[model samples]
Target: MKNIKYDFKSVIDRHNTNSLKWDYFDDDIPMWVADMDFKVAPAITESILKRANHPVYGYTVVSDELYDSYINWWNRRYDFKMSREDMLYSIGVMPSISSMIRCLTDIGDEILIQSPVYHVFYYVVEDNNRKVVENELIYENGEYNIDFDDLDEKLSKVKMMILCNPHNPIGKIWSKEELSKIGELCCKHDVILISDEIHCDLTDPDVYYNPFEVSSDYEKAITCLSPSKSFNIAGFQSSIVHTKNSELLEIIKTQLHVDNSDSTNVFATTAVIAAYNESEEWLNQLKDEIFENKQIVKKYLKEELPIIKLVECDSTYLLWLDCSALNVPSKVLSGFLRENQGLFLSAGIDFGKSGDNFLRMNIACPQKLLKEGLGRLKAGITALTIIK
Candidate 1:
């Protein structure tokens, strides 16, 4: 393993494999969904194949090793200690979010979410019969900042709040102090905080994620972490939920049982065990490569498309592009790119109304494809600016 290069550059054809990222769009470059285009680590493939070779795909029981790997990984990377009893398993992170929402809040309760966040957070909030109260992030001078005064006011009324750490779309990694402050407000206001840390392992090279449980106010917080995003095994439908509030944890457990939302496929257990224990080197190399891809985006935006400003991103593979200078709504520009150039990215409006002039690009692919996407983006933006 001394001089061997990890294979993040080779583009794999995912057309016929039922890939959500590839198959969801028709022939266009699919940069919308979060799953990476790179193949998983060799260790993960070996584990899955080894399991496949076994004859019996019987009922699966998650073992203590599964819990241990999760704990060890968090302790090793984030210095957060988690106990086996505090760790719970759910089929998917989004489902777990819904289950917790239904269990913790009564009918017509309000859940807090920051605007211009991951679109799914808004979807689940409304879909679960709850009202969404937005504490929109402050965007000024080309950077996004937490609006503490607004958040404090919002938390005072809501029964629960869902947070995306290393926030999606914006890709801002919240510092320990920032997380503690949020945790403090939630604790003081008798509000429950559910954190989606699924993107924790995908940070840039020197950046790290702070698990919400590390704060003393964590008893009022619940965090969901997944190896699916980092390892690209989202189809496995496996995620871990860590909550320090034992009483609230019991309620979530009961709701999951009632909803039957806690089962993992046969390979999910093995994949998690392999991902946290044996995939550290692969992940480290991935972060460095992603950081390089981000640099390409930054340089391309500055030199080729100076009208669009790239927000400073500290973590996650998402690059938030502010296109207000182009004087076009993001939805219109998004349609133009998809129709004219066959380029598809998450429309900024999908995140929230405040993202009307923005777009989110996924840079977790090979450099060749990254450049290709950039070319399409530049061509599309130039055409739109001319039209305007």
Candidate 2:
């Protein structure tokens, strides 16, 4: 481990802690969920402890400092300037998306999402009684790209489009030209664009994600962001939505308020403030650890398991493994890995139909745990190959 300051090498036990990834399953290695296994930054823990010592855990107000933290962080890190009035707080990104679905589109409206994308994008649209329209990404030569013609055609049918920038599952970071083109297409189709950028901060070291920048004429874009994914503080349930359109912002604020997602918990502000202000060095170290982990997986796959191809990724700790050569469905492969080798991985089918030939593995743990996961993966794949 190159990072001596941050403790990313500790293998902390999370079993029986009401952890969705650990307690909900009996698998020896839980590599399905997106949360990191490493502990949060020292500053974040100290801040939370200080807040916990306070007697009253009552309803808290969103302070100017919280907004300033976000504004300063974005300006410093991404060079993206955000106004205080343009941001709104919510429980999480999905909740904010759900509220936007209710406010912007009517029931039964078609919502567009890029497939082999985040699974929750499907649920938020369908559960709201809206139809899902997929602009399937074109995967060619082991890389993924936007099908602009198809996206343009589909945007005409859908009332809203949810874009996963620095997209999940595949971990592809969309370029600036791509973002500008998407903005242009959405504006042309008069579709409301919701950019889910919760994973923006988890990019490779010195490789930044491009924020969706809309022209002045385009006022239909909304961005949802959070420190939960980067800081491993998802339990706080805090996220913020940003929009340059004043009218749309007011409507969303009302919708979130009605959905009971506007208010923050006592510790939500504390965690966010510390994560943005003080935890940057820890996040930098985390990126280093994740980069090392990716290398470990790459070497293991090349040396021991050549059939399973590791898709190139620039962001996120989730590794997309192309298992099409196995001649087995992703569900079966993932299930076999769990049942036979006690390793849990997310099935690609959960993302979309196009992902059926792939598997998603989370590698945000210590090197010790990562090696164990690789060993289990090799064992499971070898056994499956023998059976076939």
Say which candidate scores most in lDDT. 2
Give per-candidate clash totals. Answer: 0, 0
lDDT of candidate 2 over 1-388, digit per residue (tens): 2354999999999987899999998999999999999999988999999999988898799988999999999989888889999999999999999999999999999999999998999999999999999999999989999999999899988899999988999999998888888988999999999999999999989999988853233578899999999999999999999999999999999999999999999998999999998888899999999999999999999999999999999999999999999989999999999999999999999999999999999999999999999999999999998998
Worst 10 residues of 1 by lDDT: 210-219
lDDT of each: 0.89, 0.93
1-388 per-residue lDDT for model 1 (tens digits): 4355799999988898888888867846878889899989998999999999999998898789999999999998899899999888899899999999888998899999998999999989999899999999999998898999999998999999999997998998888889999988998899999999999888889789777777546577899999988988898999878887799889998998887887778999999999888888889899999999998999988898898899998889988999888777888888899987888888899999989889999988989888999999999887877787
Candidate 2 has a TM-score of: 0.98
Estimate TM-scores for all models: 0.98, 0.98
